[model samples]
Target: MGIKVNLDEMLHQRRMTLTELSGRVGISLTNLSILKNGRSKGIRFSTLSSICSELDCEPGDILARDHSSLEGED
Candidate 1:
């Protein structure tokens, strides 16, 4: 995928556990794991907002684009 989820790194910087984030964000661990592992096809804005609020970060902090992969795209 061209978009990478930097959840693990953000969590590490915040010293937060997935379980704790799940509770704070009112999301399930399974769903959070899918996101953390980069297995998610997409994410809801509300969900992203909640995560950002709890983690004290922006969407850029959690997600990044692989410019190299887009180099050949029109």
Candidate 2:
């Protein structure tokens, strides 16, 4: 299953930047970059909750199922 991180879209919609979010979430910019770039293997619930709270969204708004990856399954 492909888990897609839509941070860019959410940030755009929220009129926010990574650096701004990092401060508001109390997370480092580098670590946020890792998650924003989809390079992180996983994220803790507490972290996720913090992000969602700051973004004013639900977890589903950040992470989504990349159904495109399952297109060729038989």
lDDT tens digits by residue: candidate 2, 1-74: 57889998999999999999999999999999999998888999999999999999999999998777776543
Which sections of candidate 2 miss by over 4 Å?
Answer: 70-74
Q: What clash count goes with each model?
A: 0, 0
Best-matching candidate per TM-score: 2
CA lDDT scores, all candidates in order? 0.93, 0.93
For model 1, how does the per-residue alpha-carbon lDDT over 1-74 read when each residue is reduced to its tens digit?
A: 28889999999999999999999999999999999998898999999999999999999999998665665543
Clashes of 2: 0
**What shift in Å separates residue 48 of candidate 2 from its native position after superposition?**
0.5
How accurate locally is residue 33 in candidate 1, as Cα lDDT from 0 to 100? 100
lDDT of 2: 0.93
